[model samples]
Target: MASKIAEAELDSVEKVFAAQEAVPSWKDQLTFRSFVIGFLLTILITFIKVKVSLNTEIIPSLNVCAGLLGYFCLKVWTQCSSQLPFTRQENSVIQTCVVAGSGIAFSGN
Candidate 1:
């Protein structure tokens, strides 16, 4: 019985060793490259949202929600696949920009 188990283990190890595969994690996942790209995209969208809010005279409630939603998305990104370290400063910046932008947009509307 012991020999049988040992043989099975050896077979499994050999099979696994024979397999050629890329790294377990995605090559671009959570790299500084991806983080920077996401950050820039967020900035641009925030800018557009504020512009629209101003043009349409949106309400404060919607502005607040929009900002919160942006942070929520960031949270998801960080939790699921982000290799980037989460920081208080980063979160604070995101929250501030999002809230301020949303406010400006909703107020305009």
Candidate 2:
């Protein structure tokens, strides 16, 4: 089973490298749509976190929330439109922006 997993990992890496060679490098993955969506989500989550903090002693997990939200959004987008210009790295950047914006929001509070 371990060997099988290792083989699968190697195959995946090979495929990634092959795909990388075929695809042109994207100069900018930070689209306005992704930025706006990420910013809005961060604001919404931060607001929820603040509200929860104020209403109860338990603190919400922002990291988990941000990760899950980003994953779900990316998954949905990928499923709905395979032709969309969004790439995996772009999704990553979006998530990072979301987390950073959330941190800024928290600092302000």
TM-score against native, each model: 0.35, 0.71
Model 2 lDDT per residue over 4-90, tens place: 999999999888777555543566666665676688788888888789888996667677677667767776766787756556666
Q: Tens-digit lDDT track for model 1 on 1-109?
A: 9999999999998797567443334433334533453455455655676666578866224444444554566667778885665443444455555555545544554
Worst-scoring 10-residue span by lDDT in model 2: 19-28
Off by over 4 Å in 2: 21-26, 74-85
lDDT of 2: 0.74
How well does candidate 2 score on lDDT at residue 16?
75
Clashing pairs in 2: none
Off by over 4 Å in 1: 1-71
Error of 1 at 37 (Å): 11
- Model 1, 57: alpha-carbon shift in Å? 13
**Deviation in angstroms for 15 in model 1?**
46
